[model samples]
Target: MTDATLTQTGREPRSAGALIGRRLLRWGLYALLCLFALYYLLPLFVMLTTSLKSLEEIRTGSLVALPREVTFDAWGKAWSGACTGIQCEGLRPFFWNSVMMAVPGVLLSTLIGALNGYIFAQWRFRGANLFFAFLLFGCFIPFQVVLLPMARMLGIFGLAGTIPGLIFVHTIYGLGFTTLFFRNYYVTIPHELVRAAKIDGAGFFRIFWSIFLPLSLPIAVVTIIWQFTQIWNDFLFGVSFSSAGSQPITVALNNIVNSTTGVKEYNVDMAAAIIAGLPTLFVYIVAGKYFIRGLTAGSVKG
Candidate 1:
């Protein structure tokens, strides 16, 4: 018999009936996905509509309709001049401060985490596994437990109550989680690659910089997204480590939304929340594929 006939007879290639069933199953999956998408997106739709409404319209409580007189005033107020407190200014500065904090914190934490992961994966030095066990334990420990000690350490280094202080705090806090993520990922990679690099006389830093980092795109994207979200959205740490001027956008958003004596502008508050979340949203949308792909590659290979 011909190879083609043999192959066809062996598996009896999927029948038309089977193909129809698969098509129906795919359509059902699509329908289910649409429902989930709608459920998750409903809140954003509400927020966008609410942000466009005036206080009068909001008080009238039309949660669904567009305002009769659409206005960009809320957007303007959110961007140019609005009061978080005595200062009636837009969230521009706080937004910028958050950008500043998140960028450096993301970069440093990813670098450290990648290095630690590489060392743990390749070196096999004495006490290395024990050190990693301690680091993993650190991930479950609550930040609140270390708050006082972290504050004191910052003071000792003269970094407390400053932007640098907040950056340092975020980096330190992010280290454990990022390290865990990268370490787990690196463990999935083949040690043969590192061994080959070493056979080529590549030293530790050279191997990491030239070989490992280039291959670590997925894990790096995951690390950046995770750390950026954590540091950017962090209110408690920002409040603790930063004073009034150096405070991040989260603190500003809080002060805007929560006030003792003033009526809250829910529209502007929602706008501010959206604004504060924009970077993380953008990062996730942009890098999300790599993030998922990285996790998939790491998990399935081992």
Candidate 2:
């Protein structure tokens, strides 16, 4: 056989060894990742299994064991039959309340943030940096710090304990973050677009609506996901700002979990917890990739 042919046909021992080593390393990394995934998912697994089990089975069987007989009675009870405090209407109303609060809050905050971001990025005015810095500072302020002033404002506006009040609270609190995200994203956009739009007789809103808004989808997704997650999962504001009738799911979940009037139905609690968490989880599962893309899109320029 020719030397070239022999070299090609017979793999080098060192190369073969390296190939085996690489395969082993890759498999090892995969196994490690799977292990970590399972570890992180353990709670969710437990919750699902427990929710499917009857209360009797939950007590008799292992905490992580699969249900002996799967049933969604707990889910049904959690959705509409269970009590949240004095109300026997389950988490249904509170879930809808959160939806109402979060939807409007996310929209209003994102819209206002887009406008603020446009202004800061394209039309720099006096004290722009100072004002931007203040907004950034507001992002880090503790929720407790603003509770008193916000409560007072809500009272004055006759918005206290209402869904709109909660919406207003979330919008105000989330503005700083939404503004930061959109501003950073907008600054990466070509300034010439704005300048050219102005030279062509486009006004502030006109340029924004025509040029910037179209390109803002990525950042808008990021901002929406962020603001929605914050507003949906917010217990502090939900508990503080809302009354019994207007309380968000988080508050209702707390009430259900802590209710002392009846049997400690572990299955029901698990189901309710899952129900409360489903929205944010679903949002991430559906749009998580876009979030990463959006974050990186702005990161290059600012």
Candidate 3:
């Protein structure tokens, strides 16, 4: 079009070149993203293929090849029949152990943290910052640093080499982070609510139950998801605190996968790994929206 018509329409032939370049750049970014996605996803593809393949196919074929014949045999074995040690029974019990450990661990930790966060965020006691700082201090200390002390304490409590010991360890370790999450999230809550509750003769638990707890749902979800995943996947605490029968899924999975015996069951190992991971994956998928909201809530400007 002529310059007059171009000006009238807010269009230019020269601008078409710029538009084409923009399109090319956008496509280039998309291509880069796709490449990265494939790079990260390649292992999952391999694991699925390997899990479905027979031992012979895995040994003879490419690692990334589609299974010659799909089989649920490995999945079944991984779930109910694979040997972790002298025990030929599969991951079922250990999975339950994880469930048992994770459920109470998440609940108790999050509950105490919610209370602690309320005390830290809303209750302005003297030395509160110092106490909160002490709590934060726990988060920085590595588990290995406290491992000996924790082990000794568990032993003293007669909880060593038991599932409860693992639960206790996870709850204590997790309290630091969960408290932090709720504290930061609660900081964003307006003080007017707390003041109004006090004026209405509400006590600490009353204010928390009535005014804060409902508002804390987003952060509670984040805390539960975080604690659940961490406790479920923890290998160190499980290995140190749990014996053969009491071991969590992680330790059991290790024993099963690394059992130096007659045959290396790659298919079974892959299937077991998937089974071990499914809970955390499912949690992330289901509550992921609340997770994002919880993370962003603390950062919002009043």
Candidate 4:
């Protein structure tokens, strides 16, 4: 009885020690996570503060300070009265153009990506893996490397300096990432779902639309938000693909912020930057739940 009791006592202390160690580990993880959160949020805080400040105050005070005179004039200027060219058209036109470009680009690209991903995930044809391998390869190539060829191709196709051209460009670029995202996601789904659908005489398009699409809500949100943000905030592609009248907000913002002879208005530039970012920001905020859901669904399922 004494030996048995001693053994019981030894196990109890070991279990208690492990509990304490786990608590310490959890606390350490939370502390590190808090630090990382602060690191990421600092830049956004600075941007917000700077946007509120007047031009003179911004130059005088530290970037971290609250504006002494908070004014919406910068936002007003950014929205309707600031000059980008000889015209004082503000960011409104470019903003509209960006919306037009992003909406169609996101929709088309996400649709194509979902279709491609579903096929890759469900169907196993000869050379399908090889084709997907090529798609993955496309993702690694830099946009800049393809710019010249893309430009020449657009010019040849009579799509140069047009909205459709920009949309097409964004869609093509988006295909790699979107396809990969959906493909990875669809792989985690049970094969029995597809098999059952097939047994009921569901064809590819019918199964995809009726069954697979409904289950794809989480990833669809992610794809839309990603493609929307990328196309909306794109500068290099906008500048390269379109002329002055056809350019997106980023190009206009660049022109506004980088005039060779004009006096730079850092405050307005900050405001314009915020405005340019707002749509994507709004997209993320609205779709935040689905994004989290999508990521969790992938991880938890795997």
Candidate 5:
């Protein structure tokens, strides 16, 4: 028999009946996915419409109904004029506070993690595994368990209630996870490159800076996104480690959302929530491409 005939007989390629069933299954799956999308997006749509509507409209109409009249005044007020505590200057200052805290925390933690990972990956001395074990253990330790000690330490350094203190807190807590990210990712990288660079008379930092750092893009994206999101959205650390004018956006939003002594301004509250969230959302939307790369970058062992 010819090879084509033999193949067709042995494997009886999918029949018309099977193909029709598969097409039906696929369309059914697509319909389910569309339903799931609407399920999640419905709340967001309601919030957007409510935020744009006037107080009277919100009071008189259905919560999920589309706004009859849209206005951007609530957005403007949320940005620059809303009351977040006694400070009636809006969420801008707190927003900047979060930006300042998150940026430095992410940078410091990521750099330290890269160095620690390189050390663990390349230069193993005696007791290295033991030390690395302890370091990894930090990743699982609950922050609440150490809060008192951390507060005392901050006070000792006169960093209590300061921006620097908040940065230090985030960096310290963030290090273990970032280190794990880089360490696991780097293990998949071949050590032959390091050996080759060493043969060229490159020192440790020289080889790392020139050779490995360039290839660190995928893991770096993962690290930055992880750290930025954690630090930006942290309410506990923001409230605990910082106070007054130095609180991050999360803390400010909480105060505004829960404030007493006024008729509840639901529209402003929704707008403020959106403003507080937009930065991290923007970051994710912009760098989401890197997230996919990061997930798969360490899959292959070379």
Candidate 6:
């Protein structure tokens, strides 16, 4: 064989071996990731299976085992019939309570944040940085620190222990986060847009409504997801600020899980936990990709 032919033939085996090694490494990584996914998902799997089981079957079977006979009685009870203390009313009312509070809270905070972001990013007024710094400070305040003052404010407003009260509280608390998100995102937009709008005699509100708001979808998604998840899952504020009737589903779920009145209904507890968690889960499942995209979109400038 020619020398070139021999050299070419000799390289083939090494190349093939390298390719095989890469394939094996890739498959190993995939397997490792799958194992980790299963490990993290184990609790949710157990909760779903346990919720489907009869108490007798749960006692008899392994914790990780699938149900012998599937039933949604626990789900039904959790939604409408489960007892929390003296009240047997399930999570229905409280679920609606959360929806009412979260929807308005997310909208209000996002809208106000968008406006604040617009001003901070493009308006460039005096003392803007100082005010923005104060907002940044607000973001770091702990939930416990605001409990007393916020409670007193709610009392003064006569909104104590009401759904609207919860809405107001979440909106106010979420403002810092929403404003920060929008400000960072808005900074990424060219300032020329605002200037061009101003040249067209567009007033502040007009320019924001016509130009900025339309381009706000990405950061808005991020802000909405953040606020909704926070507000929906909040237990401290829900419990501390609301009466029994106005409590959010998180509080109700806690009540259901901790209720000591009867033969501990493990199935109902699991189901209730899942129910309380479903909205946020659904939100994440649907908008999770958008959330990542939005975060990356704003990350370039801020």
Angstrom error at residue 63, model 4: 3.5
Better of 3 and 5 by lDDT: 3
- TM for every model, in the order presented, reads 0.85, 0.91, 0.93, 0.85, 0.91, 0.91
lDDT of 6 by residue, 1-302 (tens): 11121112233445777867866766676677778888898999999999999988988899999999999999999999998888998899889999998999999999999999888988889999999999999899999999999999999999999999999999998989998999998888888777888899999999999988888888899999999999999999999999988989999999988885757888989999999999999999988998999988853441
Higher TM-score: candidate 2 or 4? 2
RMSD to truth, every model:
6.9, 6.3, 5.8, 7.5, 6.3, 6.8
Residue-by-residue lDDT tens digits, candidate 2, 13-90: 478778778667666766777788888999999999999999899878899888999999999999998887777788
Compare the candidates by TM-score and give the number of the best one. Answer: 3
* Candidate 3 stretches greater than 4 Å from native: 1-14, 298-302
lDDT of 4 by residue, 92-191 (tens): 9999999889999999999999999998998868999999999998889888998999999999999999989999999999999899989998988888
Candidate 6 — which residues are off by over 4 angstroms? 1-17, 298-302
lDDT against the true structure, each candidate: 0.82, 0.89, 0.89, 0.86, 0.86, 0.89
lDDT of 2 at 270: 94
Question: Candidate 2's error at 38, in angstroms?
Answer: 1.4
How many residue-pair clashes does candidate 2 contain?
A: 0
Residue 95 lDDT (model 3) = 97
Q: In angstroms, how far off is 87's CA in candidate 3?
A: 1.2
Residue-pair clashes per prediction, in order, are: 0, 0, 0, 0, 0, 0
Off by over 4 Å in 4: 1-38, 260-262, 299-302
- Please, what are the lDDT tens digits per residue for candidate 3 over residues 1-302? 11121122345637778878866766676677778888999999999999999999998999999998999999999999998878989999999999989999999999999999988988889999999999999889877788889989999999998888888999999999999998988887788878988899999999999878878888999999999998999988888888887899999999999873887999999999999999999999999999998877763343
Poorest lDDT segment (10 consecutive residues) of candidate 2: 1-10
Model 2: colliding residue pairs: none
